[model samples]
Target: MKLTLRTVGVFTLCLLLTACSLPRGAGIEQEITAGANDADADFAMYPVTRDFLPTLAEWPVVGEPELNWITASAGARTQIINPGDVVAITIWDSNDNSLLAAPGQRAVNLEEMRVAANGTIFMPYIGDTRISGLTPQAARARLQSELEAIVPSAQVQLAMAAGMHSSVDLVGGVNAPGTYPMPDQSYSVLSLISQGGGVSGALRNPQIRLMRHGQLYGTSIARLYSEPHLDTRLVGGDRVIVEEDRRYFLSLGAAGIQDQHAFPQDVVTALDAMSIIGGVSSSRADPEGILILREYPASALRTGQRGPRQERVVFTLDLTTSDGLFSARNFRIQSGDLVLATESPVSSVQTVFSLFGSAFGLVNAVTN
Candidate 1:
C-alpha cells in the first residue's frame, strides 16, 4: 500500500509540472505574431477589442434575391387602374331621355367593360375615355364630363368589377399561402402577412422578402417588427414572402453543448450566442482559448493591409480578463461561424493523473 501511494503521489506531481508546458490547440493566439516558420496556419488573427467589435459587426448580413416590380414607385407604390381591368359604368339620365337607355329600360347597364390596351373603357354615348391611371371615382367624373356634351344631365357611376389584377400574393412558409386582394390602394406589407395567419414557426427570425419589378428587398421578421416604417405599404401585383432563416453556427470542442444552432434573433452577439449553447464546459474548456473561426472575402483583407491577405480569419478571446468580457459582449456572431472552446492543458494533465491513480488503487487492492 505504501508503494502504491508513493507511485500515485509521484505520478500526480509530474503531471502537475507538465501542465505549465502543455501544448495548445489551433487558434489565432499562436500565429497572430508567428514568424515565417508557420506557413500552414494562414489567416488574419484579430484580437477582440471595443473598437474592433463594431468593425466585425459591420460584416454584411445577406439580403433577399431580386425580382420584378409591377409598381415601380418608391416606398410601396400605390395601386392604380391598369389595362385588362374590368370596370362597371352605370348611366342615369335626369329625364326619360337617357342616351344610355335600352328599349324600355330606365338606366343603361355598361356591365364589366374591359379596359382596352389604349388605357380607356368605352362609355355608351362617349366612345373611349381614358381611365387606366384614374381611380373608380375619378373615372366616373371623367365619363360624366364627356357625356355632358350629348346628355347634358347624364349621371355616371363607376366601380371596379374585377379584382384579379389588384392583389398581393402570400408565398412560401406562410400558414395560409394564397392570393389576397388589397383592401384599398393603401394596403400595407404587414397587413398582407397578417392576412395569411402570420409566418410559420418563430416570427422573430423568419425572412421577409418583398419582390417588385425584378427588384428584391428583404429583411428578418424581427427587424421588420422593430422598425415599423420598414413595413412599407404594398401595391397591386406585389408579392410578400415569409420564409424560415437557415443561418446557423457550429459549437464544438469543449462547449457545454456541441451542435449547430440557428440564431434566435436577427443580430446575435458573441456573448449571447455562447450562453444560448450552454456556454463552455467548466472542467474541460480553456477560458483564454475561446476561438471564433470565420471566412472573409480575400478582397476585404487586401485593402490597407501590409502582408499578403488570406480568406480564413481567426478571432480569439481571452475571457479571463475584464477587457475580453466587454469585448465579447459587443462582438457580433456572424452566420456559419465555427465557435470552438479549446481544451485546457491543466485539465488534460489532470485526466492522465486520474487514470494512473485509479490503476494504482486497483493494483493495491488486488495485492491485499
Candidate 2:
C-alpha cells in the first residue's frame, strides 16, 4: 500500500511540474496583462468604468473619416429654367398684319428653341432675353412683356423642358439608378431616393454620399431617417450614391465566435460589440478580464488629457461588476478594434486537476 501511494504521489508531482506547459486556447488574464505593470511597457492600460467614460469620450474620434452632412433647406416649389433647357413659344396675333405671324395666319409656333449658355433665347423682332433663373410661368410672362412693344395684341404661351443641367443622378445601391429630372425646385435627396424605389434592403447600414460641385458630403441612411432636417435638397447636376458600411472590428481569444463583425448601426457600443461577437465562451472566459485592443495614430498621442496616453491602448472591462456593465453600454467601439476575452486562470487549474486524476488512475492500474 505504501509503494502504491508513493507511485501515485510521484505521478501527480510530475504532472504539476509540467502543468505550465499545458495547451490553452487563450492566454490567462494575468499573463496577458503582466507586461502592463512594467514602467516602460509599450502599451497603456485603462480600466473601463463609469468614472473613466468621460475621459474616453474626450478622445478624438478614430477609425472613420470625419464626414460632414448638409441640412435640409426650403427651395422654390416650381421648376426654374436653366441654360440647357429647351423652350417652346407660341404667339397669337389678332392684327391684320403681324411681324411674328403671316398675314393670313393668326398664330406662329416657335419649337425646339434651346436656351443658350448666356441664359438667353433669340426671338423674332425682340433681342436675346435672359430667362435662366426664372420659373416657367415667370419666363412666359417676361416673353409676353417683351413682345407687347412690337405687337400689342400678341399673346405669348411658353413651355420649358428640363435638360442635363436640371437633373440629378442616382448612382448606385438603389433599385433604379439613373438620371432623374427635377420636376420642381423642392426635389430633395429623400425624394430622389423614393423615386429610385428606396435604398436596397440587402445593404447593411447603408451610407449616403452626395457629390455636388466637386465636393462630397456623406451620412448614414439611419441619420437621414431619424432627423428629417438632414434630408437635404438636391441641386441640379448632383450625383448621389448609396453604399454599405465597410467599418468592422475583430474578435479573438476566448470569444464565442472569433470573426470580423460589421457595424450594424451608426454607433456601436462596446456592449453592442459583445453581442455582435455572440458573447464570450462561458467555460473558458474570465468575466472580469474582457480586453479591447486599439491602435491610435501617432498624432493622437499629443500631450493632453483629450488624447490617448500611448499609440497602443488596452481597455479592460470587468463584466462581473455592475459599473463595468453599465459603462460598457455607453462605451463606443471604433473600427479595426480587437476584442479579446481572456481565459480564466481557474480553467487552467481545472485542466491540471483533471490530468492529475487520470494519472492517479493509471498508477492504480499498474499497482494492481
Candidate 3:
C-alpha cells in the first residue's frame, strides 16, 4: 500500500507515542521493592528504638519560656572557693607604723594578701587569723576589728583580686574554644560564645549545651536562635559546649548528582539538597519516578532483637507537572536520608547506542 506524506507523518508520531508508552516490566517494580527492602535491611542492622521520637516531640517549639541559669539544676553554677586566693584589702585612716614594726616590716608595700593553705593570713601583729568562707565585705569588717586594737580607727576594704570568682568555660565548635573569665559575674550563654570568637564556620545549627556539675542541664541552638529568651545566663564552672554540624544525608543511584552532603539547619529543603549534588543526570534519570529513603534516628524506631525499626515511605513525582510541585524540591531533608533516581528505558537505549558508536569509532581507527 502507498503511503502519503501526511499518513507517514501520522504513523511516525503514533510509533513514537507507542514506544514512550510501553508498559514497565514487573522487574522494574520488583527492583524498586527490592531496593526499598535492601535499604530497610541496611537500616535494620542498627539498633532502633522509639525513645528519640518522644524526645524530639518534647523539644520546645518556636516560642516558650526561657530557662533560668540559677533554677536549672542540671548545669548549676558552682563556685570553688579555695585557699591561696589573693584578696585585696583597703585600709583608710590607718598608718602602717604597726604593720611595719611587726613581722620585721615585711617589705612595707602590701597591696594584697594571699590566703595560706591553712585558711589563715598573718596581718602584722594580728598573728594567724582564719578568713575563709567570708565574703569580701565581711572579711574586711573582721580585719578592721582585729587591727583596731593596734591602730585606732582603722578602716578596711576587701575584694577578690585573682582567680575565677565567676566565669564559664566555652568549648567545642567555636572559633576559640576555651575558658572565659567573667569578671562582671553576669553574662548570658550567647555572650560567652561571642567572647570565644563565635561559632565555627563549618558548623550549622551549632548546638550549645549547659552542663552543671557534670550533668546535662539544657540544650539550645536552633531553638534558642528562634527564641532569644532561651539563651540562659552563664555561671562559674558552667560548661558551654558548642557541637559541630555533623548531620547529613546521602544521594546515590541514577541522580544527576551522587554524593553525601552535610545537612543544613533551617533553610535546607528537599529540593535545595538535590541541587547541591548537581540535580538529576538527565541522560540516565527517570524524571517521572524518583525515590527518597528517609532514615529516622534509631531511637525513633521500634526496638527489636537485631536492631531498631525503620519507617519507609515512597513517593513519586512527575517533572512534567506544574512548576509549583517542583518547588517542593526545597523541602528540608533529615539526617540519614537517601535520595535515589531511577533510569528510564529510553535513556538506557540511548546510552547503548552511544557506547556502540564509540566502539565502532575505535575499531575504524584501529583498522585505519
Which candidate has the top score in lDDT? Answer: 2
- Candidate 1 similarity to native, TM-score: 0.80
lDDT of 1 by residue, 261-348 (tens): 9878767788987898899878778898788888865554655443225677778888998999999988878788888887776676
Per-model TM-score, in order, reads: 0.80, 0.92, 0.58
Regarding lDDT, does 1 or 3 come out ahead?
Answer: 1
lDDT of 3 at 311: 44
Highest TM-score, which number? 2
Q: Candidate 2, which ten residues in sequence have the lowest lDDT sum?
A: 1-10
Residue 276 CA error for candidate 2 (Å)?
A: 1.1
Task: Name model 3 segments beyond 4 Å from true.
Answer: 1-30, 34-86, 90-152, 162-165, 172-175, 200-205, 217-226, 295-299, 302-332, 349-368
Superior candidate under lDDT, 2 versus 3: 2
The weakest ten consecutive residues by lDDT in model 3 span: 44-53
- Which residue pairs clash within candidate 1? 67-214, 67-215, 68-212, 68-213, 68-214, 69-212, 69-213, 69-214
Alpha carbon lDDT of each predicted model: 0.72, 0.90, 0.58
Lowest-scoring 10 consecutive residues by lDDT in candidate 1? 63-72
Please give, for residues 1-368, the per-residue lDDT of candidate 2 as tens digits.
Answer: 33566666787888987886877777877888788878899888999998999988878877887789999999999999999988899899988878878889999999989999999999888989999999999999999998898889999999877887899999889999999999998899999999999999999999999999999999999999999999999888999999999899999988989999999999998899989988988889998999999999988885768888789999999999999999999989999999999999888798798888888777766767
